[model samples]
Target: MSQSRILVTGGSGRLGQMVLDQLLHAGVSGIITTTRTPDKLGAYASLGVDLRHADLNDPQTLSKAFQGADRLLLISTDDLFSGRRVQQHTNAIDAAKRAGVRHIHYTSMPEPEASTAIPFSSDHVATEATIRESDLSYTILRVAWYAENPVELGLIPAALRTGTWLTSAGAGRIAYVTRSDVARAAAAALVRDKETSQIYDITGPHAMSAAELAAALSRSVDRPIEVRQVDDTALARELVASGVSPQLAPMLVTTDANTRAGNFERVSHAVQELTGVPPTSFESFLVKNKARLLGATDK
Candidate 1:
């Protein structure tokens, strides 16, 4: 449904920035973005996008920022170490409800229950429950693993540097979709007139296993990546040994475990259905990011 305004939480992050771009490109009007650091969104403001200072961490600030918004896009929080991811999401959902948002769109994962390995996944499950419990119109975009995860999570760089790709996800395939494709899907859902309660599994066109990922990266970066399959514990230790924070290591470990269990094996056409654009392939993402991936390894 068309609305007077739409609000996006966590607007300063990478995915949020891309979602804002998609919304602007779609000619979406009355866009409001919330971030703890509003000054960081000056560029968005320059483009006539409404910017507001609202920290999901601080529920008090959200009331004002969430007000005047007819629709809302609740981006899941990434505050893994804080032990407050669920509470933060709850705060945003409550604020949106009180602000009288008619419809809500959320960026979730492919299977909420399948994220048992991922400790932070509770936040997504909890937020979805809260949104549904509120009896508001909602669309949950179950965004699959990002195609850029290897680079985003430092796996690509580390692999390139060490010539080894370590994983616990043996023969498990993940339908990794690009962040931009997920953003486009979110933007499309935000502006659509549908008020139905629904969920869309936003995934890439194809699924690939860890070994296949290594091969793709090898070709893209023109380097040999030796795939080493290890248990979850060993994977965690390796990540920590490679400079990953001790706290973040566990979450990474569980992500692989979840994949190994086939939790992320679902490949859906929801991205194209929602955005009217084909989801970018993981191979294409690697090719496009070849330069940046190599540069990160050098660092």
Candidate 2:
């Protein structure tokens, strides 16, 4: 059989870059990647990845970018809380079908069909349904929360400053995996020859509650932190007061609701199964990024 030509969308983004690197490390050639700003991906172009300009919102660019691709990685966009994201995803899927892409791998959130508590779940659910209804073979990778997201989201710093982390997700457990692990899994799925449609819930090894997460942060930063439970409305109000975008506050608030409902508590070995390595743990991630988390200039 001929080798597959892989096309990865959003190749300059965090997760997409990692996936591209892993595919290269696995010795897979004929790789293609798409980005709106191709100049930003000079490193990838140097590595022989066919870097093409494609915008999910612009269907005109997708078909050409997807040409000759045996598999396509439809990395979901980061435009949360906007209704346009779903439409953009649908456009990509339609274009991939038109381009004769055989298999499509999509990065999606866990239990999108059942996790109504998360405002963005409907978008992923809709996208997944579209991929399923199409003629292409598909792999649905339902990713868990990123272990580093708490620091990036300002949750850890907020807990450090206030000595309390207010949350609506009371006693909710999350199996937070890393973006690197998810990317590796995506690369593995792309290289493997799977004849049938598949769905994998890629997650960390274990689940922990908000209190546990706070304790882990405290240990990493060497500062005391506390978890304070609050209602969704209160959390949303606090987030807005803290300068979070008013449009995004509600979605964050509902994420807590979803967590509290155990929607994110599932732990899976999909990462290990796919990449042959266990996913990174939350504590290890915190320890590795302690300096950055503590506001230090260097590690």
Candidate 3:
């Protein structure tokens, strides 16, 4: 165990895998990645990438995972609204400090400062505050909305099925960030010669309204689409009814409220400076994923 090792939690996730790939592409040495299920990451293991099953929820597992790592990347768990998730982060932070990890990089939301409406942001802000007060050096990447988030999970599927992108973001403008940019920025921070222990707001190139984004998607997919505002309360209820868990409803509601309040609009230069490339444009995303996105329509 040496101080040169870098440990990345959530290493098997889409964004984490991208970070791992970029790191391997750079031939950076001493990278360690942890997953809840190591078997699924056999591809990475085959490439001689260090993989371990270390669930942050377990204190003992987290302690072992944090061992010998000079820097840690806490990619924030996806358990959207559980208090236990926040507690899991607290455990990781505690374990990292105890292990004498020099630095930590945490992925957070766009405007944590203005995201009081969102329960998720509160957790993010609390964890960030804890990091600042702790002796261990820390860097927080408050990322903007992922361009892929909308297309992959939130809107595109529904838009394709119903010809409308329904959301609560009434007139809010969003600067769509990309997961690849987040990954690249993370890799830079992990391998940089100098430590960056401050908060960096990573964002995409342009800001657009929900209507504008829907128009862009329609143009890309060659289909007619409309952006419609949905009731946040009803959406929450539907999510709960559809087995999204009652605990998560508030988080979704708060997030949509934040969106409606225009908290996702801020732009920043951190991505370009950190990754040595500008964040991908929304149009670029459509171009790259058009085939997959429009496959259903084409068939």
**Candidate 1 regions with alpha-carbon error over 4 angstroms:** 1-3, 240-248
lDDT for model 1, please. Answer: 0.85
User: How many clashes (backbone N, Cα, C below 3 Å) per candidate?
Assistant: 2, 0, 0
Q: Candidate 2: RMSD over Cα atoms?
A: 2.3
Task: Note the Cα lDDT for every prediction shown.
Answer: 0.85, 0.86, 0.79
Question: Candidate 2's residue-wise lDDT over 79-146, tens digit each?
Answer: 87668999999999999999989999999998898899876789999999999999889999999988
Q: Using TM-score as the measure, what is the rank order of every candidate, best first?
A: 1, 2, 3
Kindly report which residue pairs in candidate 3 clash with one another.
none
Per-residue CA lDDT of model 1 for 1-299, tens digit only, reads 47658888889999999999998888877899998888999999999988898888888998888889988999887887588888888888888889999888888887887677776677788888988998889999888988877676777777888888888999888899988898888988888887899999999998889899889888988889989999998998997777566765676677788899899889988888887779998888999988898888787
Evaluated at residue 76, the lDDT of candidate 1 is: 88
Poorest stretch of ten by lDDT in candidate 1: 243-252
Model 2 misplaced stretches (Cα beyond 4 Å): 239-251, 296-299
TM-score of 3: 0.87
Q: Residue 183 deviation, candidate 3, in Å?
A: 0.8
Off by over 4 Å in 3: 1-3, 229-256, 296-299
